[model samples]
Structures are given as structure tokens and as C-alpha cells.
Target: MSGADQATRERLAEEIRSLRARRERLVDELVQSSGPGDSGDASQELQGGDEVAAIDERIAELEKLRAGRIDVQGVDPGTEVVLRFSDGSTQTFKVVAIPEEVLAGEEDITVTSDSPLGLALAHGQQGETVRYPTPDGAVEVEVLSIRRPS
Candidate 1:
């Protein structure tokens, strides 16, 4: 009902902090790109400017997710889930509110809230089979289990 979950909020806050730090470093690079009485590298300046702008945009986006979001829909980021493919093969994935939430961790597979598969799985219960479209076509996956990360 609010924004992102607590873990997602913390990750977003950390990401903002990291981006800000990188932006500061980029700013310093921009300042150093040109020296007194020296011609500047226009290409480098433009690239740094673009990167800074992107960072700023991302920071703004993350800042808005500082509350509860997916929980209101019955699931949250950092939720570990098991799924069975149509072939009867099973795999585990950690559900995240955003693509950026895939941090280095034990869970290598991730499902973001914005993706088609993620959208299909949202608010799904165990034993529910959800279908989502992919470039190849539609795929069906059965939810085996869903639990918060320990």
C-alpha cells in the first residue's frame, strides 16, 4: 500500500548512496577534464555529463520507493520462491521489486516486478500456475513455494 518493502527500501537507499558517490567522482573527473589554459576533451565531458544525468535520474527514482510496495500485493522483494517449469523441472529465484535489487548473494536467479514473468507471478499462491509471454511465446510456470528470505 505504500512503496517498496524494507529490504528493498534499504537496497534502494544503498544504491542511491552508491550512485551519488559515483556521481561525485564523475563530477571531479569533469572538473579535471579541462585545466587552466588547456583545451578540454569535449567527448569526455559529454560522456561524463550523460553519466551524471543518468545517475541523478536513477537516484530520484529510487528515492521514491522508500516505503512498502509489493507487500500490498501479497509479495515483497527478497522473497525466495520455488517454481516448476512446464517440463517438470524446478528452480529457485529471489523476487525483487526492481532489477537493481539483484545484489551479490546466494540467490543467483531473480524475478523483477516489472518483467512479464514477474508480473504473472505477482500475488500468486503455491500450486498456482501462471502464464507469461516471452519472445518465443507464452510460458507456464507453477509456483511450488514462496517464503521470505531467512
Candidate 2:
């Protein structure tokens, strides 16, 4: 495995641990609230349930990612890139190692490492133009700048 692949595995494992802890906490909260006659705030319970479900989904995704081959090179989570579209419109996006991060609704626009744009960006260097296939067609984009994830 390459350094990037090992690094990605470590990061995914860390995220899984953190998410499992969070899921535990959410479950604990729900337990404390109990149900209808158990002095539970139904609204809070409902919200907590929703959060728990989301956490579970993320955990599953991360686990699958950790089990797979990590060949998405040159881009790790938090890697930022500025891309110039064919229309000359430039946009900055933070590339995440997994879809879980993007689903977390980060402040900056985010893309998964497996995404077409993300994969294309990962293999390209600064000032290089890369093409990604979209349902519409192949979209050509130029990488204006790349900030490696910390």
C-alpha cells in the first residue's frame, strides 16, 4: 500500500471510532429519555433517533471504505482545490476521503474522493486541466490551485 492509502485507512479508522462514540452518546441520550411515560421529551427523542440513524449510516459507509482499496491518490480529506470550469467560472471545493464527510454538510462545498470530479482533481496537478464525465457529458476543468489537506 502507498503512504496515501495507509494514511487514508488510518483516517477512516479514526473517523469510525469517533462516530461510534458519538452513536453511543446518542443512544445513551435516547435511553435516558425512554419513551412516552418515561418522562421523555418526544421531540428530543425523535431528533435523537434521526441523528442516530445518520450516524449509523455514516459508520457503515466508513467501514466499507476502510475495507476497500484506497487508490484515490493525491487527495486526502480536507484537500482543497480551485477549479476553473469550461465556462470560466471557478469554484473551490474541499475533497473528502469519503461520502460521509460530504454528508456532514461542511461549510465549504465538499466532494467525495470517489466522485468523478474529486478523482479527476486528485490525479491532476496545479494548473492542469482534467476532465470528468457527467450525465450531461464530459466536463473539462482546470485546476488553478491545490491545497493539500492538513
Tens-place lDDT digits, model 2, residues 17-93: 99999999889878987856633587778889999999999888777777764556546667888989888899898
Residue 44's lDDT in candidate 1: 73
Candidate 1 lDDT at 72 equals 29
Estimate every model's Cα lDDT from 0 to 1. Answer: 0.74, 0.76
What's the TM-score of each model vs. the native? 0.64, 0.52
Per-residue accuracy of model 1 over 71-145 as CA lDDT, tens digit each? 323256567789999888999987776665566663458877567877777778898988889999999899999
User: Clashes per prediction?
Assistant: 2, 0
Clashing pairs in 1: 3-68, 3-69
TM-score of 1: 0.64
Candidate 2 lDDT (Cα, whole model)? 0.76
Query: On a 0 to 100 scale, what is the lDDT of residue 11 in model 1?
Result: 72
Instruction: RMSD for all candidates, in order, please.
Output: 4.5, 7.3
